[model samples]
Target: MTTDTIITARGLTKTFTVRKAVVEAVTDLDLDVQRGELVAFLGPNGAGKSTSLRMLTTLLPPTSGTATVVGHDIARDPAGVRRRIGYIGQGTSAGHNQRVRDELLSQGAFYGMGRRAAATRADELLESLDLAPLATRKVLGLSGGQKRRLDIALGLIHSPELLFLDEPSTGLDPQSRANLWQHILDLRREHGTTIFVTTHFLEEADLFAERVLVMDHGRMIADDTAGNLKTTLAGDVITLGFASEADARAAAARAGGTAAGSSLSLTVDHGELVLPRLLRELDSVTSATLRQPTLDDVFLALTGRSLREDAATSKEEINA
Candidate 1:
């Protein structure tokens, strides 16, 4: 690994025996994340996203292969890896009864921080995450968004170089999600922390992440910028509505597009340039609609299924 590489993995695999049947949770995953990059890991449920993270974070050992996190070999020196990285899991990590500031202080103590240092760090996080007003509030009394912010504070108690977040904003409302992300962006901007996160919200990844890694069926399939993936894999979609089904079919034949009912749809690299030409060439088009591709479109093109459908399904299937 290079000096600037925060994480490096090759042939990382994980397996489990479920009712006497072997299930591959993750397979031959190879990845490299540089320092100060915000990477979003995307996958359908039961697609091994969580399992891969568990192995990399040293919560679970890889069945085979090797990885280094924060300059420490995960298999040979788990303690070293754990000491340098922060992990905020799907579930809340704070105790319900403990006060927020005390919870953070306790987390610092767990990381071997002295009492005075832990207190100082806790105060800093409380202010940075906007949790200072609620520092003495009981954990259970805070709202869902407040709890998530506290979770982030606990993860950063040791000021680790890298942070791994698993569905950090899954259950928050739209406004709360936006608030949480703003704090995350500020953290990265202020501290230059490398963030590797898995999120169900595709828009969050598209808007904030520097790179996106897509996984399916226990294997890494695609990795690139969200813009590049949408442009190359999904492209722009143009829908032309005709006066009749026959007119639609004729237009499809002339334009090399697909015809369904009274509509002709075409996928092109640049819809703005192609749509006007197609409209001038075809006289039967009664209406035209040009749509830009989203990250969901990229997922559908890659997997032959919509990610929204997969995301709506029960998350319990991928608990491993």
Candidate 2:
């Protein structure tokens, strides 16, 4: 690992033996996370995102390969990794019965902090996370957003340099999600904290994450800044209307539609199908609209399915 590298994984693979067969959560993975980078793990549900995160955090042992997180080997330096990183999972962990401020102070005490320091840190986090006004209320009595803020504060109580958040905005409302991301950005900017976060929201990755890693079916499909990925698209997806598929193809051919079929149409990878390009290529074309490609478009192009379908699939599955 290099000096500036904070997390390094080599051929990481994970599998579970539920009964007679093996379920591979992650397969032959390699990852390099530089210090202080907010890397977003972008994938559909059960795409080994949470599993990979859990393994790296030393919460679960990997089936194969090695990782060094925060300059410590995962296999041999689990304790060191634990000491250097803070993990906030999907479920709410703080006791619902206890007052929020008390819970934060107790977490600090668990980290061996003095009472005065713990109190000070609790108050500081309360203010930072917008929890100061509700500091004395029991977590159960708090709203979903407030509890989530409390959870984040608890995770940061020890001031760990690396923070792992798994679906931080999973069930949050739009306003709460916005609040959570604001604090996340602030944490990274103010403290230079390295963040490794996983989320199913493509918009979240597009807007907030410094780098987006697109994963599908347990394999990485695309990894880059969202803009570059859009630029890489085939020269504008041209959807044209015609009396028939052949007419559409004929029109597309005039406008660089090498693979045009029917009104469905086609274009180069990450191509910008703008009004200018359309007008230059196909004057015969009648109505056309320009649309900016999104991370969802990237996901669909790679996974062959919309993200909504993936989310809906996991939600609709019946229990065993």
Candidate 3:
């Protein structure tokens, strides 16, 4: 591992046996994350997103393979790894009865910070995360957004070099999600902290992460920038509608597009550049629309299923 590499893993695998059947939760997972990079790890449910995180954070042991986190071997020096990294999981970590500031201080103490330093750090986090107003408030009294912020504060109480967040904004409303993300961005900008996050919100990953890693069926499937992934895998989409199905079919044949009823859809390298040429070449185009491909479209192209649909279905299954 290089000096600037904050995380490195090779052939990491995790397996479980249920009903006398072996199930691989993560397999041959190789990854490297450089310092100060915000990486988004994405996949549908049952895709090993959480499993990979658990292994790297030393919360769960990998069935095979090796990983080094924050310059410490995860399996051989879990305490060293844990001390240098902070993890905020999907669930809340604060105690219901403890005051918010108190919880932060407690976490610092748990990491062996001196009383004065812990108090100072706790106050700093309360101000930075906008939790100062709720410092004396009970954990259960804060709203979902406030509680999530407090969770982040607790994670950062020890000033770790790397932070791992698993679905940090899962249940927030749109406004709250936006607020939380702004704080996260500010942290990365100000602290130069490396962030490895897994989120169900596709737009968040596309908008914020420098690099995106896609996993499915316990394996790494894709790794690239969001724009590159969309461009390379899904491409831009051009839809042209005709008055008659025959006209659409003719246009489809001429442009190598797909026709459904009276509409022809074509995926191209650049829709804006191709649309004008296509219009000049084909006649009887009643309507035309060009759109850039989204991360969901990339997911559809890769897994043969929509990530949004899969996430919804998984949530329903869990609730059932």
Among the numbered candidates, top TM-score falls to 3
- Candidate 1 lDDT over 134-206, as tens digits, reads 9999999999999999999999999988999998998899998999899889888888999999876789999
Who is ahead in lDDT, 1 or 2?
A: 1
The total number of steric clashes, by the backbone 3 Å criterion, in model 1 comes to 0
Q: Which ten residues in a row have the lowest lDDT in candidate 1?
A: 311-320
lDDT value for model 3:
0.90
State the lDDT of candidate 3 residue by residue for 118-156, as single tens digits.
999999999988899999999989999999999999999
Candidate order, TM-score descending? 3, 1, 2
Tens digits of per-residue lDDT, candidate 2, 39-103, equal 99988888888888888999889889999998899899798898888999888969979999999
Candidate-wise lDDT, in order: 0.92, 0.81, 0.90
Clashing pairs in 2: 233-269, 233-270, 233-271, 234-268, 234-269, 234-270, 234-271, 235-268, 236-271, 245-262
**Model 3 stretches astray by more than 4 angstroms:** 1-3, 280-283, 315-320
Query: RMSD (Cα, Å) of candidate 1?
Result: 2.3
The segments of candidate 2 whose C-alpha lies over 4 angstroms from its true place after superposition are 1-3, 233-235, 240-253, 258-274, 280-285, 315-320
